[model samples]
Target chain A: MSDLKNLRGKAACVGAATTGCGEAPGRNSTELMAEAVIHALADANIPLHEVDGVFAATAVHSMAAMSLAEYLGVHPKYSSGSNIGGSSFLAHALDAAMALEAGLIDVAVIAYGSNQRTAGGFKSISEPMPFEAQYEPRNPITAYALATSRYMHDFGATRDQIAEVAVAARAWAGLNPEAFTRDPLTVEEVLAARMISDPLGKLDCCLVTDGAAAVVMTRAERAKDGPQKPVYLLGAAMAHDHRMISEMPDLTATSAADGGPRAFAMAGYGPNDMDTVQLYDAFTINTILFLEDLGFCAKGEGKDFVGGGRIAPGGALPVNTNGGGLSCVHPGMYGLFVMIEAIRQARGTCGDRQVDGAKLCLAHGNGGVLSSQVTTIWGTEETL
Target chain B: MSGYFDGPGPEAEFRQFLADGKFMIQRSKGSGIHVFHPRVMVPCSGETDLEWVEASGEGTVYAATCTRRRPEKGGDYNVSLIDLAEGPRMMARVVGIEPDQVMVGMKVRARIDDLNGAPAILFEPA
Candidate 1:
């Protein structure tokens, strides 16, 4: 019911943290989250006690707003503890911005933390619904495998073509000092990595790291008095199809196919206007599928679009500039990283990793086997 | 008389009082017709007049995936989305085929199997 045009806020993303990539740290989820929140507040030059709202997103652990507020030693006027999947963090930013515009809260802190890599922590605790119980557990890798199979069947795409996406990501990671796996990987290395699922190798899947990230958002007017630059929330959209992989109408096309255009239209920009992209990369297939679904390329042509150095650093569209969830730190909080990188690029604070002359960036998040999608367009200017 | 009814809780329960081998699908206690899973629900005009039908267990693979990485709780297995000839798609395990052998539109038949001592349906190449 909220109109995109009515949305107005001067929001500055302050502070961000990741545990890098690989094994889960010994630290608990709450500790990691609190650390990120404190760091973000310091980065924005704001006292931690001044934060008025808190929003948290997590899949592997639960931490309510009150508990987090207690941990951070800040009593927030407004709070949220919703879990909409990886993209939930970005959704939280939009929600915070709306709330700020409506005078609900002046400052909001959105954070995500998880320990998925720790032993005995990566499995679902609850049983599947009765309908879902009938089927085998289709993990993310398998969900992507089904879509990859269809992609190959329909487009005549080959393993080599898909491997190019990994190759490009690793190439970018080589340039990112904060990236988890910096070693340059070739198409063969990617193809030969331990096969997690048929047609999907170890390199094709994202790493599960233990980490947390936080962003302090406040009204543009408030942020203007704080940070030197404010990255405005130009547009945002969310969409869903079916929860279970089996019930999805089509595996290749995402709800983003609908959500992307709507967000872009709201922002008054197109794919070409984006200087950088932070797409959710749960797997190589998902990246390819989203490229098509987001209108970056034609349907069934994602493999071809990614084959060249297009997504590389100097290519047409520099994607996952922070190495993404694949090569960067994936805390099961993948969406947070996307937002972090987009803010960095839009603020032009990425230093050596900054996309030259960047102005517009797209941050995308995927939840539940690509079941839910949230697309956000951010800019250096205040559009509303 | 055997009948399916709502449980004391907010969930639906299937009460097998008769051995008619007939399964009636419905959206709610008071909807139009009875469909299957993923249909949201089948509307039935009245609960008493619900139509009962037999399942063929014959279907085709609408989509499938080979999973080498499954949650620790769920044993590793290949998963698939199957489309029945009667007009509904369901999730099941693909058996009797190599991971590379599974393809879309492949003919398959459902086989009810024991999953940790409970009844669960799986599929194999027909």
Candidate 2:
């Protein structure tokens, strides 16, 4: 294995933005994505001419990289179109960093945009080609609901405990100006929401919206000139389990069980070192499961760990500080937002919602129906 | 207009592949049980070898969840992960009991249930 430390470069996150989820009256996926890319360049204080590579991530929407590059009017040195579910953006960021380190591309831009609300509201494409025909045709909601049920059965976790996750997330969302679902949600409201899949109510599932987010990566040397306090990418890891839910070793554990430790080891840091965490919360149960899998708490102790206001704003280890996929805008690419929030918090760019002296952040992303997972550790110091 | 469950033909032949004992669950290669649909060839390397074994219907419920809303093709059913005594976990619908009675690590046994007149393996509390 090549030492990631040896591949060191001044990797700086130049631009980051997420289109707030809601009805986009007249925008398609490509149009939304183009606008996001332009905004990201402006945010980074970089010119389009400086960008030499483009990495695009999306689940449902399809726009070729070359076509998008043509639309954006910037011919790049290298380009890639990655489709690895929601985690693709974060994985793309790491890929950009590695490519920059390898001298394949100097400046790489990663972007994700989708009109899932309109696409799903009106009849859009069927499940992507890869998952279209499975023995048990896995739908995200149904697959996650099955896992939620298992968690409840194994841990004696009650409906109230699961609702607590939603409640805490919404509380954080209330503080975030960019969050979409800011209405204060209660345990009662969560339990009472319309059921989509048994045990998984409307509150348990993430929202679908037309939105876009982008991130720019440049070598560490170049980054210092852009953002005064650029957050460095210390380490990254990705893992994939059996694609179908049935083939999974256990629904309670995700591929993260394999990915998380490797990422921490590569960065030479432990979970305790992280001052803040941004876990992928497509469903509230996922957050609880991650709490256990990431070693924050022992297995079956997640219910208890989250019950006593621990994961909330003033708790021991504050999580989802910018709200999560549950209460925040879920643009199908929620992981990108996780990375965005982590960067904002680490840089202390977030005004009131920022954690005090947060030096380390853990950003996790989930792809497919818990099929693929990736974890990235970022900090102020170049630990590697 | 294509419906959700619109299949090319009846799934009876696939079910028979399991009942007649012709179906073998190997740890590796072109074998193993069919847990997910649209069977694809699973390659087995030397590290993970193929082993022929019979499935002991008896197992414990690793996890289970109830569904009130389902695609129009499939009605409301309980989806669960059953840990077979033979050492593999499978996903199937749980039947023959009320929702509240379902518990994790609860004893369960495999039984064939009809899905739209097609027989599919299901689990029930023993």
Winning model by lDDT: 1
Off by over 4 Å in 1: A8-10, A14-24, A118-129, A382-384, B1-34, B38-52, B69-76
lDDT of 1 by residue, A1-384 (tens): 866556633454555555423555677777777887887887788888788889986664455576788888888788887776788887888788777887888779988766667744454432474566545454666778777877887788999899888888887888778777889888999888887777678888887777778888888777767654777788788888867676677877889998888788778888988899989998888888888889999999899999878997788889888888888778765898888889888888887678998888899989877888889888876444
Look at candidate 2 and tell me the lDDT of residue B77.
56
The two-chain DockQ for each candidate, comma-separated, is 0.57, 0.35
What's the lDDT of the predicted structure labeled candidate 2? 0.74
Please provide, for model 2 over A1-384, each residue's C-alpha lDDT reduced to its tens digit, 9 standing for 90 to 100: 666455332466867766635656577777777788888888788888888888886664465476678778888888777767778877887788878987888888888777778766422333543322322433777678778887777778888888888888888888898777889888899999988776789898877767787888888778777744777887788888776666777788888888888778777788999988999999998888887888898888888888777898888887898879888778766788888888888787877678999888889998877878888887774443
Q: Model 1 shows how many backbone clashes?
A: 7
Model 2 segments more than 4 A misplaced: A8-10, A62-64, A121-138, A381-384, B1-57, B70-75, B98-102, B111-114, B117-119, B124-126
Give the per-residue lDDT digits (tens) of candidate 2, residues B1-126. 965334432234345645563323434444444332323233333233333444567888876666664458565556676777766676666688875356678899877655444456677888
- Give the TM-score of chain A, superposed on the true chain A, for all candidates in the order listed: 0.94, 0.93
The collision pairs in model 1 are: A10-A220, B31-B44, B32-B43, B32-B44, B33-B42, B33-B43, B33-B44
DockQ score, prediction 2: 0.35
For residue A304, model 1's alpha carbon misses the true position, in angstroms, by 0.9
